[model samples]
Target: MEFDYVIIGAGSAGCVLANRLSADPSLNVGLIEFGGSDQSIFIKMPTALSIPMNMDRFNWGFESVEEPGLNGRRMDCPRGKVLGGSSSINGMVYVRGHACDFEEWREAGASGWGYADVLPYFKKAESWMSGEDTYRGGSGPVKVNNGNNMKLNPLYEAFIKAGNEAGYPITGDYNGFQQEGFGPMHMTVDGGVRASTAKAYLDPVKHRTNLTIMTDMMAEKVILENGVARGIELTSKDGKSETIKVRKEVILAAGSIGSPTLLQRSGVGDAASLSAAGVEPVLDLPGVGQNLQDHLEVYFQYKCKEPLTLNSRLGLVSKGMIGTQWMLFKSGLGATNHFESCGFIRSRKGLKWPDVQYHFLPAAMRYDGRAAFEGHGYQVHVGPNKPSSRGSVSITSPKAAQKPRIQFNYLTTDQDVEDWRNVIRLTREILNQPALDRYRGDEIQPGLSITSDEQIDQWVRENVESAYHPSCTCKMGDRDDTLAVVDSNCSVRGLQNLRVVDSSIFPTIPNGNLNAPTIMVAEKAADHILGKGLLSPIDAPYWIDEDWENRQRPREPKNAMM
Candidate 1:
């Protein structure tokens, strides 16, 4: 089949491109997804997020190569294989990262990617429940709702209150003027269902006759001809191999891991690595899979003194009741991911922005809800948002089915170690506040006995897990950058009629979850793809404590104690 644009992977970015590119009925767009339809009940039910993330049918259960930094442990890296990609299976939290993060991107040779240049796209993609403002978007495709209403769980209140007691200012919205503080988390959930890119962008336009979505079709390689991308060779679910030609351009939205692997398979990566993997090199792009980055977090579990935690509600009867409520009325415990309250904070006094993030849950368990403690308990998933360590994603073989070799090389730097130590120290202080005196219990994961820096370092090495925010495998930057794969326009640096619009194009990892930022990237790229002029940069002011240079806490509030 021939189309104006052939997008690989009907994930977050591809879905957005499909909807936007097909807006002109005269243009044809084809979207390919390796996984099946996202029609399962488990995907729609917000609380059942674990079901899709842990099941191989919905997730590409890719494990990393043993990391030397984490005591030689192999970490599990799950990416969504379904229609919406990782957006369909990720924790529903919606975060745009610190504004300065985008500024850093601009400073790192990613022109037109500063905070001012990107905010307009971020605003354009969100329909925030709280209404429009200079900082928040109100009339957009994705539905963003604050899920941390105190009425949902008392622990949320305690978590925020504890932050205040710990001398941190309370910002009602972290994705607003100020990102560094405790606040209600925004979720991509509307009416108790996941608002994946497919639901927000694709579903609304799926009926457009100009757009075609092919699920269960795995892209084997890009059809490159004389330094230009022309089509894609893919394997159908029924074992049929075919080539779909693109009349205009081919966009690779296969995510951080999938995108780079596809490029290498298509002979567009580092020549040395390609030769070793038995693939003839078409273009020697050394950065195709370099600069791999991700967030690693460890759960800080604590037994709860009260029966208010979700553990009490996990019984079979309770599950049935919650499921019934959600199935019938789209309300109840099943309506939320229970990651209601969260925060972002700097690890130390001199940092420019929040380097650490917190996701407070009312239950003490792993992300997949396994290994529950015997009684009521709670936990906080905390980690450094930006790690200095860098890694790579490389093709191990020429075959399309073979997974790429992912090595995050996590915790290899001294700054990473220091940041992790700070997370634990600060988290312990917050949990010990008088605000949580009523609910705080004995520490569970890294108990109080683990106090020394050496002990904390060991605990982190043994327990840290990927925050599932892998990105930057094919970073965007100035053409002069030796390792840049794509330019600021999202086009491949050395190839024509080819571009990458996904998390993989990030110049660096943002300070929060990747879904919101990935969507913003696609929104921005759509304008570029259609030859539309860039949005006027919005110079919105973000929060910065005047005393930030001198103290950890803001100085204006004289009575505030640090």
Candidate 2:
């Protein structure tokens, strides 16, 4: 088959590209997905997120190489193998990261990627439930609903109240004028169903006749001829192989791990590494699989004094009731992911923006819902937003079916260690506040005995797990950057008609969840691919504490409370 664009991986970015690029009606666009259809009931039910995340059928279940810094333990890195990619299996939180994150991207040679330049794309992708504003989008594809603060369990209120009592400012919307504070989290959930990129971008446009979505098709390699990408070699589930030619471009939207591995397999990566893996090198880009980064979080669990947590509802009867409610009316406990309230804060003074992020869950359970506490309990999922430690994703063999070697090298730097210490310290302080005094119980995960920096560091090393936000394996930067795989326009360096539009193109990891930002990247890239002029940069003001360099909290009393 021949098409105008052949997008590998019908994930977050590919879905958007499919919708936008196929709008011309005459242009043919093919979106290939390695995973099967996202038609499972668990995928649509917001609270059933853990089902897809833990299922091998839906999750790639990639594990990192044993990290020297993380006490030599291998960390599980789950990426969505299904249609929406990680967005289909991620915690349904919607965060765009601090505006400063985009500014840093621009400063780091990612031209046209500053906060002012990227904000328009962010706004263009969202249909926020809170209505339209200079900062929030209202008429976009993705449906972003505000967490039901009033109807949420009391634990969410206590979490936010504790943040205020702890002297942190309370911003009504973290994605609005200010991001550094406690507030209701926005979720990519509309009417109690997940609003994945497939649902928002692809589903609406699938009937266009010009867009072809092929699921269960594994992309083996990019078909390149004389430094130009021409097509993709793919294998079907039934073991049939075929090459589909592309007339315009071949965009790699396979995500951080998948994209880098595909590039290496296609002989577009480091020559030495590719040669060692028995693949002849077509291009010698050293950065194809370097600069890997992710967020590592430890759940700070606390037994609840009151029985108001989700722990009380883990029984079979409760599960049945919740499922029945959702299946019938799309309400009850199954309606939300229960990460209703969350915050972003600085660990200490002198930071330009919030370096730490929080997702408060009213249950002491892991992401996969394993090892659940038997009684009422709660936990704060906290982690550093940006870690200085870097790693790489490299192919161990020439085969596309083999999982790539992923090494995040977690807690390898002093800043990363110090940030973990602070995250634990600040989280403990928040849990001990008067607002939570009614619900807070004994600490469960780290325990009260773990007080010293050394003990905290040990706990972090032993317990930290990927927040599932792996990114930057094929970073976008100026062509002058020695390690840059893609240019600022997301075009592959030293290659023609090939581009990468996914989280892997991030110049640096953002300050929050990656789903929203990945969608924004595809939106921006679509404009570039169509030869359209860039969106006019908006000068929307973001919240900044006047004394941020000197103090963690603002000096104004009004800023301290909602």
lDDT of 1 by residue, 1-562 (tens): 8999999988889899998899988899999999988998888899998889999999999999999999999999999999888889988899999999999999999999999999999999999998899988999999999653557788998898888878788998889899999988889998788899889998999899999999999899999999999999999878899999999999999999999999999999899999999999999999999999999998999999998888888778988998999999888788888888888888788888888899999998777777458998999999999899999999899888888899999999999998888888888887788888889888898998888899999999998989999999999999789889999999998899999999999989999999999999999999999998889999999997766667765523222322
Alpha-carbon RMSD of each model? 1.8, 2.2
Which 10-residue window of candidate 2 scores lowest in summed lDDT?
553-562
lDDT of 1 at 11: 87
What are the per-residue Cα lDDT tens digits for candidate 2 across 1-562? 9999999998889899999999988789999998988988899999999999999999999999999998899989999999898889988899999999999999999999999999999999999997789999999999998646537588888889888878788889999899999989889987889999989998888888999999989999999999999999998888899999999999999999999999999998999999999889999999999999999898989999998888878788989999999999987778888898998999889999998999999888887775456788899999998899999999999777888999998888999999888888778877788888888888898888888999999888988888999999999999788889999889999999999999999989999999999999999999999999989999999988888889976633222211
The regions of model 2 sitting more than 4 angstroms off are 555-562
Model 1 error, position 413 (Å): 1.0
* Model 2 TM: 0.98
Q: lDDT per prediction?
A: 0.90, 0.90
